[model samples]
Target: MAELAFCLPDLPDVRDFATAQAVQSGMSEEALADFLVAVNEVATNAVTHGHPTAKAVLRMWSVGRVLVVEIHDEGRWTPETPPGQTPPAPHATSGMGLWVARMVSSDIRFETGAAGTFITMSFKV
Candidate 1:
């Protein structure tokens, strides 16, 4: 397992952390690309949309051939629409992250409460 505690300005480092963990899990070249895409999108949302002054934690682990990543943030955001359920409009500029995450990752889950929000994604490595 690997973990990184990051802030908004540490987005690049978040990618590095996730890349390293995915490599260690024996992810394939093609799969790694998709995995990073999802990681970048989710991590961006984590640091930017989460609570002010909040610290985000990213965790990566493997179970058999599955690679699991969890991004946890100290925020209580209610989604305006069900996230990752549909792709963004063709002309839309933003709001593409969640939908893209769903397309590339095998499984994506969201949870929020007084503790914060947890986005758990899984990839088959």
Candidate 2:
């Protein structure tokens, strides 16, 4: 597995790096776009909603024909309900990041606690 651990200032760089890593790991062109979109959305949320000075760790790995990417943030924020459990209201602008991520990824899982939140997104390779 490969990992990129960073703080808010490095969000963009991490996104680019993660994309490159995913492509290099044999992700298809279509999967690459979708993976990048999902990564950006989750990473953005980590920085915006997470605690001040929070850090994020992005890890990528492959198993069989599946590619897995996990984004972990060192913040205490927790959602009242699992994101994307239901579609967001139609006229809503925000609150769609997780929904978009869910739509693009093959599978998504979340783990949260007093320490932080960890989101794992899987894609078919």
lDDT of 1 by residue, 1-125 (tens): 78999998899999888988999999998898889999999989988899889889999999999999999999887887769898789899989998999999999999989999999999998
Model 2 alpha-carbon drift over 4 Å, by segment:
none
Highest-scoring model, TM-score: 1
lDDT for residue 81 in candidate 1, whole number 0-100: 73
Estimate TM-scores for all models: 0.95, 0.89
- Model 1 misplaced regions, further than 4 Å: none
Q: Over the stretch 1-125, how does candidate 2's per-residue lDDT look in tens digits? A: 99987777887898788878778778888778778888998998888877667678889898888888899887765668888777779899888889999999999999989768899999888
Per-candidate count of clashing residue pairs (backbone under 3 Å): 0, 0
* Candidate 2 collision pairs: none
> Candidate 2 — worst ten consecutive residues by lDDT sum?
75-84
